[model samples]
Target: MMGWLWAVQVILFAAGTGLGMSDARRKSTEVRLPLWVRMLISLTLTAAAFALWRDDPASSSKEWIFWGMAWSFIGDLSMAGIIPWRHPMIGGMLTFAVAHVFYIAAFAAALHHEGLDLMNAGLAVVAVFYGLVLIAAWLLLIRNPDAPRLFNIGSLVYGLWIGAMASAAAAMAWSLGGALWLTAVGGLLFVVSDTIIGAAAIGGRLLRHQGYWVWLTYVAAQMCIVYAFTL
Candidate 1:
């Protein structure tokens, strides 16, 4: 039954991905899952995170992911506008940023075992790498002052944090190649997912099939991260 639980999660994620892609593929679709149902499918994130606790909740790294994923679930609802907050978008942004903080901490913890020099070198590579991405977002969102800009202020800070998270995860992969590579992959996917979201939100509209790509990358990102640690 425990193993079956993971299978069920895969099923839910696949179903949710299909529904989301279908909805986003074309506006002319005669049928669609309600927005709330689509958002609820994200509960699988929480469930998978919970399963990670089977190893050792006392471990700081595991605990961080546990809480991080919990925040991510809330973020999903907030972004979907299912939460009753007056400013659900802001709430989602804040919650997901917090989630990244926890993930950064967890990733950093894992890399601490390696020498500080190696870890720092790896992180520096990504920090510098993501600067180009940051510059691009600024260029795109500059024209639309009215639209939400994830490149601005608090969102900018959040972007950097996730960049740092990516750096840490990459450092781990470099120093200890194996399942840690999945962590690196997950981190990169996260950055990609968020970049797509920021671009669309800043433009005030999703590009053709952009929503499908967003959900697909986001789900895959979380799954990779979870599976990396669990492995």
Candidate 2:
């Protein structure tokens, strides 16, 4: 029944995403939903999921994952709705970034008192990669003055945060020698999702059939990431 619940959660999330995209296609901006309503729905679902995992206390990984999902839904809702009050739109991105950090913490907690040498080196390498990719993304986006500065900066922060999580997971795997390959893949999907969004925000008009590719890429990215966290 608990597994079924998680499956239902996935279905709801998919439906919401599809509906949101359909809305996007019809309307340039997303239709607004109240933030409190969104938060309540997310909280209720998360509480149910948490109840399912209570029996298996050893699977602490799922706890982090559960909260991550909660935060994700909130962030998604936050991004979708336009608040009447003056608020920083980037707050949603920042909140999601923090959620990714929780995922990193979960991966780290999974480590069994391992030494930090290998992990530190891995983190350093991932940091370098993150910097390089950020630079490339900005260089590409900033060429056009019309490109939203907020969008570019948000992408940079998101990329770096997810990159760090991926690196942390990789480092944990190296230290413990377990099958956490999904973490790395999840990080790659983050890149894929952001790249699609960036393309749409920048050269989408120039690119032929940008809408189809963007939709496909973003959906795939989300699906990959959802499964990655479940792993």
Number of the predicted model whose lDDT against the real structure is largest: 1
User: Model 2: what TM-score?
Assistant: 0.64
lDDT of each: 0.71, 0.57
lDDT string for model 1 (10-99, tens) is 676667656655775677643334465446556766776776765676667777787888899999888887787776766877899888
TM-score of each: 0.83, 0.64
User: How well is each residue in 1-231 modelled by candidate 2, as lDDT tens digits?
Assistant: 555645665565556556656676687854322334334445545565356346456666656766666676666566556433233346566767877866676666666434344356766777688668766765675234665766666666666676677677666655654345656665666665555555555534334444435434533443443344344
Clashes of each: 0, 0
What's the C-alpha lDDT at position 88 in model 2? 36
